[model samples]
Target: MKVTLERTDLLKSLTHVHRVVERRNTIPILSNVLLRCDGGQLALKATDLDLEISEQIPAHVEQPGATTVPAHMIYDIVRKLPEGAQVSLETSGDNATLELRAGRSRFALQMLPEADFPDITAGEFSHAFTLTGRDLRLIIDSTQFAISTEETRYYLNGIYMHTVTTDAGERFRGVATDGHRLARAEVPAPAGASGMPGIIVPRKTVGEMQKLLEDPDAEAQVEISEAKIRITTGNVVLTSKLIDGTFPDYGRVIPQNNDKTMLVDRDDFKAAVDRVSTISSERGRAVKLAISEGRMVLTVINPDSGSATEELAVDYESDPLEIGFNSRYLLEITGQLRGDTASFSFADAGAPTLIQDQGAEDTLYVLMPMRV
Candidate 1:
């Protein structure tokens, strides 16, 4: 195979496929990227058994062929090459090595037979849909932080995605919970998504998909079945195996009748929590929020560290409520609010508190209280 491409174009393609290549692999071929040159295009592919990503970019093809080479090494070589320089890659039929050349630099990389690469089976998807990059970014940014890292639960280790019917109409929703906290966000369901089965998108897939959705103007085509999910853009395609577990009914955990409510400036609340959390215990990082009439005081006390307090005025009229929660959780949820005002609904210190953006009703967060 012989191909010539500008450094920038080759580097971009490498960045996308490299994410799927593991630093260490039990199978030697798994650590290498499959490169195929034909029809004036170069296809780079990488996989980690469970997930696969492929990118195709324009290149000058002098000879048509394919080979596998260390994914990271080639990417690094091309990346460090002089900017705008032309890079040439070639491997003769008798050679088991890939020769890379750019200006005054050259390197010979060992190649594996393309036939040794594992095949990724992407069965027919039951549902196919399209979504703007903006819609996908919103759903992932809002809920990804709350996904469970606990391996024991397995099911909570990803974002739970499905379609739901709201008072306004039907929407696509993403929910994540780690028992202590839960985040739920939704966007109007796109066309072709009707009756789509809910799927748990694994954490790694969520991150890689997020990267592909960075271009706000790009549209992503998504296909899904009970066992796997695929996302395709103009330049790349990513496919992954779905987690084989059922997500718990998250709707049941959201507070239903927490009538007492308070509206506070999102920035003020976040700042207060951050300052008071300085004195919080290392293990719990707990902060107590005491709200009364029209004032809210955030206090943190640790046995080894001195206590700290910060007060923020809020629009609270209900009876006083004192609740303790993980300071990090509060900051993360508040950061997701798009508007200046963060609305909080409370039932008591013992029950979960519901929080939402006063200006955006599509997103919601639930936080379980800890005993102070």
Candidate 2:
């Protein structure tokens, strides 16, 4: 293949596709990116067997052909090229290597036969839908952090995605839980999503989707089946094998009647928790929250480190309650809240606590309390 493309265009596409190539690959071809130039467009693809990403960028194609080269190596070479310089890639008549040229720099990389690249996007999809990048991001960002890392309970490792009918209307929802905490967020369901089978998007795919769908206004096409998912954003297409497992009935874990409500300035509460948790031990990272009529005191006591405390005024009229939670989890949840006010609903210190942005009912978080 002989193609010349702007450094910026090639570098951007490489950044997205190369990330799918893992550094350590049991199969040599898996570490290389497949490059195909034809019809005035240059396409780049990379995969780690389980996940694959492909992107196309405009290029001046003197010849139309395809070859595979190290994904990271080509990405780095193009990334370091002088800004606005043209990058040319060509394979010799023998097709054993690919030559990359950018201004005064040049490198020859070994090429693998394009026939060796695997194709995983073949099967039929049960459903297909479209969502704006904004909605797509909101679904993952709100819950991704809570995805469980425990490999044994494999079902909890990815964002659980499905459609639900609420009293108000049908909504598309994403839920993730690591046993200790759970996050659920939803957007109004789009066309072609009703009755679609719930799918557990693997952790890596969810993260890649988040990164690929960076433009708020861009539209993303989603196609899914019980075994895989494909997301197309702009010129980029990402496909991944789904985790074949059943997600637990998370609804049972969501608190139903936590009536005691507390309103606190989100910034104030976050700042207080950050200050008090400074002295918290790494192993036990627990921060105690003592909530009373209109005051909340945050405290952390570590045997190895000194205790720290911070107080903030809140809007709670219920009886006093003290609860402990992982300080890191608290900060992460608070940072995701979009409103100035964070509403907390408590049912004593032993039960799961529900938190949400005061006026935004589309998202909610549940945190299990720890004994202080």
Q: Clashes in candidate 1: how many?
A: 0
> Across residues 340-362, which tens digit of lDDT does each residue of candidate 2 receive?
99999999899999999998889
The model with the greatest lDDT is 2
List, in order, the clash count of every candidate structure: 0, 0
lDDT of 2 at 95: 49
Error of 2 at 81 (Å): 0.9
lDDT of 2: 0.94
Q: Quickly count the clashes in candidate 2.
A: 0
Candidate 1 local lDDT, 1-372, one digit each (tens): 899999999999899999789998899999999999999999999999899999899999999999999999998898899898999999988878999999988899999999999867557899999999999899999999999999999999999999988797889999999999999999999988879999999999999999888898899999999999999988899999999999999989999999999999999899889888988877979899999999999989998968998889999999999999999999999989999999999999999999999968789999999999
Model 2: colliding residue pairs: none
Q: Indicate the worst ten consecutive residues by lDDT in candidate 2.
A: 88-97
